[model samples]
Target chain A: MKYKDFNHWELAEDAYFVNWVLRPNKHADKFWKQFLADHPEKSEDVLLAREIVTNIRYSDKPRLNDTEYNDLFERIISTKRSKRPSNVFYVREAQYRWVRYVAAVTLVLASAILYNQYWLSSHPSDEKTIQTLVKESPRGSKLTAVLSDGSKVKLNAGSKITYPKEFSDTLRLIYLTGEAFFEVESDPARPFRVKSDKVNAEVLGTSFNVRAYPDDRKISVAVAEGKVKVTNADQSTVRFEHTLLPFQESEINVQSNQVVKRELQDDMIFAWTNWKLVFKEEPLSLILKKLERWYGVEFELKGAIKTSETYSGSFDNDPLKVVLEVLTSQDAFDYEIQGRKILITSKY
Target chain B: MKVFSESSITSNGELKKTTSSRKLSHQEIVQGLEQGDESVLGYIYHRYVQDMFGFGSQFTRDRELVKDSIHEVFASLIARRQSLEKIRSIKSYLFAAVYHRIIYDIKKNTTFKNKNQKNNYREFNIEFSVQNRLIMEESNREKLNKIKSAIKNIGARQRQAILHYYYDGFVHEEIAMIMGLKNAHSVTKLISRGLKAIRESIAVVVVLFMTDLG
Candidate 1:
C-alpha cells in the first residue's frame, strides 16, 4: 500500500480502504484493525480517510422511477422469454394448460426437463421417480400430458405426475403428488387408477379431478362424466371403499380416516381446467393459498386478516394484480407488487 | 502496498467472490447466464446500474441515449451468453461495453450533428459530491479544501483512472481493460500520478495542522 507516506486523501481514494469503509466485513475489519495497530503513526490518517470514504457520495447518481423500472424490467424479460425453449416434450406443464397459461401467466413455458432433472438428481432422497416419463409443473405454471392409453392429464402447479411412456397391457396407473384432472380413455380390460397419498381413484372409462396435495389435510376425488371408485390408499388391514357417480365428490379425511360425500348441481368442480378460479364462500386464507399457485407468486400479509369472514368470487383468467385489487376493493386491506412477490395487508 | 494476503480480505478483480460471500459465485452466475436466468441478470443490473449510468453519462448528455446503451449492453450480454468470451469482472465489462455502445451510437448519428461533436464528447467528466462530513472541524475542512484543489490539478486521464480505481473499487487489472490501457502497470502509473497530486496537497495540510497546534 505504500501507506506510510500516503496521507488521508490518498488513503481515502484507495480501493481496498474504501471497500473496507463502505462494505465492511470480518476480514476487512481485521485487516484495518491490524493496519491501525501496526502503523500507529498513520492511524490518524487512516481514520480520517475511513471517515471520508464512509460519507462519500456521488453527485450525478441516476435512478429510474417505478414505472420506468418496471417498463425496462418487462422489456428485458420479454426479450428473454422469446428465446425460451419452445420444445413441447421438455415442458413438464400440462399440454392444454399451455394455451391459457401462456395468455395469463408471467412466465412463458420453457422445458423444465433439464431444470427438473438437475433438481431431481441433486435431491435423491425425495422419493426418486421410477416411471419412464416424469411430468412436473412448478408454481405458476400448468402442464398437460397424453398418456400412452390415450388418457389426457392436466397437471396443476407445484405438482408432479409419473406414468410410463407406454402403459403396460395389464393395468394403467399414474402417481399424483399435487392436483390433476384426468380424462381416461375407456379401456374396459385395463382400469385407469390415480394413486395418491390418501385416496386412490380407479375408473374404467371416465373423466374426473383429484385434489391430493401433500400439504392438504383432505384428499378429494370428484367425478365429472363417469363413475369413480374411491378406496383407501393406506395398505392397512381395515380397507375403506366408496363409489362416486357423476356430480358426486368424495372427501377423504387423511387424519381421521373418515369419508364424506356430497352432490353438486353441476359437474363444474373442475373450473380450473378452463383457467377459472372459483371460490364460493371460501375463507380468505385458503383463497390466498390458491392464488399463490395460480399466479405463481408469494403473498405476505402484514396485518391481521379478518379470518371470521369468507370471500366468494370467480376470477376467470385474470392477472394477479387485478385479482388482488378486486379482492381488496371493499375489504380492509391493501396490496403491493414487486417482481413475483405480492404483499397484502389488512387495514385494521 | 505490496500484495497483502488476499486469502482473507479481497480477491482482486473477482466479483461475487469474497471471504464474506455475496451468495452467488462467479461460476454460478456464468452457469445461470448460459441458461438465460433472469434473476441473475436482475442481480447484476441492480448491483451496477448506478455505476453504469455514471460511466455512460461521461460520454454524452442525452439521458435516453445512455439508457438505450445500457439496455443494449444487457441485451447483447444475454443474447451472446451461450458463447460469451470469459468475463473477468461484470462491472468493468458492462462499463466497457456501455462505453463502446454509446460511441457506436454517437458515430452513426454524426451526420446530423457537427463533425467536432465526437471530440467535444470524448472527455471523461467527473465531480465529487459536496457532502460535508468534516463541517464541524476547521482543520478537516482545510484537508477537504486541499483535496478539491488537488483533484482540479490532476490530468484528465489520471482523474478517470483514479475514479475507476478508488470510486468504482476496481483493481488495476480490471481498470486496465475498462480504460483500454495496455496493462495493469500503466493503470498503476496513472493512478499513482493522480494520487501524488492529492498527497502533496495533504502534506501542505499536515504542515498547516502543526502550525495551528503550535
Candidate 2:
C-alpha cells in the first residue's frame, strides 16, 4: 500500500488521512485501525499525523455572552439606523422626517448654491421647479453632509453635490462637480445615481468616489466598497457603460468619450475622505495640483516646473507651510506663500 | 431537497446538539431563509456571530467594525434571499461575505493610521500550532516544539490555506475562492509547498521520536 512509504508529515498532509481524522466513518475507521494493527511499525507515524490534524487551532474567538448575542439579533432585525441629527462623516443615521430634514438641508445648501452664482448661471436651473438642494465645499476645506436618505457624502475641497431633499419613490438622483466620496445606503429598489459633469454612476448600494473636477480632463469613479456602474454623459452619442467591483475604478475622458477600467492601486484614493494626505510615488506637478485644492493656494512656477521627479510620503493633514518645507527639501525648489498664492522657483 | 453533508457542516454545523432529533440541519435553515422566514437570521447570527467576529478581527482589529460587518453580511444575505438556492455551504458563504465586507470596510473606514496599519490591510492573518495537551506533556515537549517551529516557518498565505483546509473543512476550490486565488491549482501548490516545508523541518525530530518510541 502507498501508506507504507509515507512519513508522519506526509501522512498528516494527505487528504485521505486527514478526512479519516477529521470526519471519521465506520468503513475508513475499520480500515485505518486494521492498518495500524497489521503494520505495528507504521503505528507511530499514523498516530503522529492524527495528532497534527487534530491539534491545529486558531486563537480563541471573541464571544458575546448570551445577553449580548440576543440584543445584537434584535438590533440587526429592526431598521437599525434611525437618522436623528448625526454628525458629519460619522453618520450612522436612520431615515425619517422629510420636512425637518429639508429645513436643515436648505440652510446649508441655499447659501452654498447662491455663493456659486457664476458657476450655476451656466445651468440656470429654475429653483422653483424641481426643489434641489446643493452643497459646495469651499477651496482648501472638505465638507461632509448626510443626505435625507441616510447616505453620506464627503465633498472634497472646491466640490459640489446637488441632491433632492427627499428622494422620489422610484429613484434617488444626485449631481456632482469636482470630486466627492459617497457612502450610499443600500436600497436596491431605488438605485442611487450620481450624475457628474460628463459621466454618470448608478449603484444600488455602494461606497465609491467620483472625481469630475471641471479643470481635469478625465472623470474617474473609484469604488471603495460595493459595485458602481459608470457611463458617459448623454452628450456622448456613443454610450459608455461599465460595472466596477470593489477596489476597481473607471476613468472616462471628456473629449474622447473613452472608458477605461483598472484596479485601484492603493487605499490612498480614500485618504482624502479620512483627512489624510498619502502620496505614493506621485509626480511633482500632480502633487502641486493636489496641494492647491488642499490649501486653496495657486502655484506660480518659475524657472522650471519639475514634472518628472516623483515624491512619496504620508501626512496627517499637515499645515501648508510644513508640507512645503518637506516637499522643497526633497527637490531643488523654493516655495513662498503670500496671501493664498504659492510662488515656487525650481533651482535645477 | 439534498440533506447537508457531514464535511460541509463540520464547522459547528448543527443548530443544536441534541440526539433527540429536533436539531435543525444546515439545509433546513437555508431553505427557511429562502422562504422569507426571518427567524433563521436570528439562528444564523447567534450561531455564527462569534466565528464571524473572530474571522473578521483577523483582518481588521476594530471590534465595532467587525460587528457591523457581520450585521451587514446577514442583512444583505436576507435582502437577496432569492439567490440562496445555489449556495452549497452556508458557513463558507457567510465567511466569504464577512471576509469581503470587512476588507471593503477597511479600505474606506480606516480613519487613523497606527504603526500596524501597513501590515494589517488585505491579509488573512493566522497562527499554527500543535494541540495544547500534547505540547504540555513531558514526553512530547521536544518533538512538539520541533513540529511547531516547522509550522511557524510556513508563510502567511500558506498558513491561511492550511487553516481553511484542515480546521474549516474547506476543499481546495473553496479555499481558492476564499483566498481570491485563480483556482484550486494554485491552492494545491500553496498547500504542498507549506507541507513540504513542515516536513523538512521536522524530519529529524520524527526519526528521533520514532527511535525513542521503539
Off by over 4 Å in 1: A1-32, A51-57, A83-348, B1-22, B120-153, B199-214
Per-residue lDDT over A20-61 for candidate 2, one digit per residue giving the tens place of the 0 to 100 score? 888899988998988888788998788778877775666445
Segments in model 2 whose C-alpha atoms lie over 4 Å from true places: A1-129, B1-68, B71-214
- Candidate 1 RMSD to the correct structure: 20.8
TM-score of 1: 0.44
CAPRI-style quality class for the chain A–B interface of candidate 1: incorrect
- State the TM-score for model 2: 0.50
lDDT of 2 at A29: 96
lDDT of 1 at B33: 86
lDDT per residue (tens digit) for residues A178-199 in model 1: 6777756555667777765445
Q: Lowest summed-lDDT stretch of 10 residues in model 2 chain A? A: A99-108
| Lowest-sum lDDT 10-residue window in model 2 chain B | B1-10
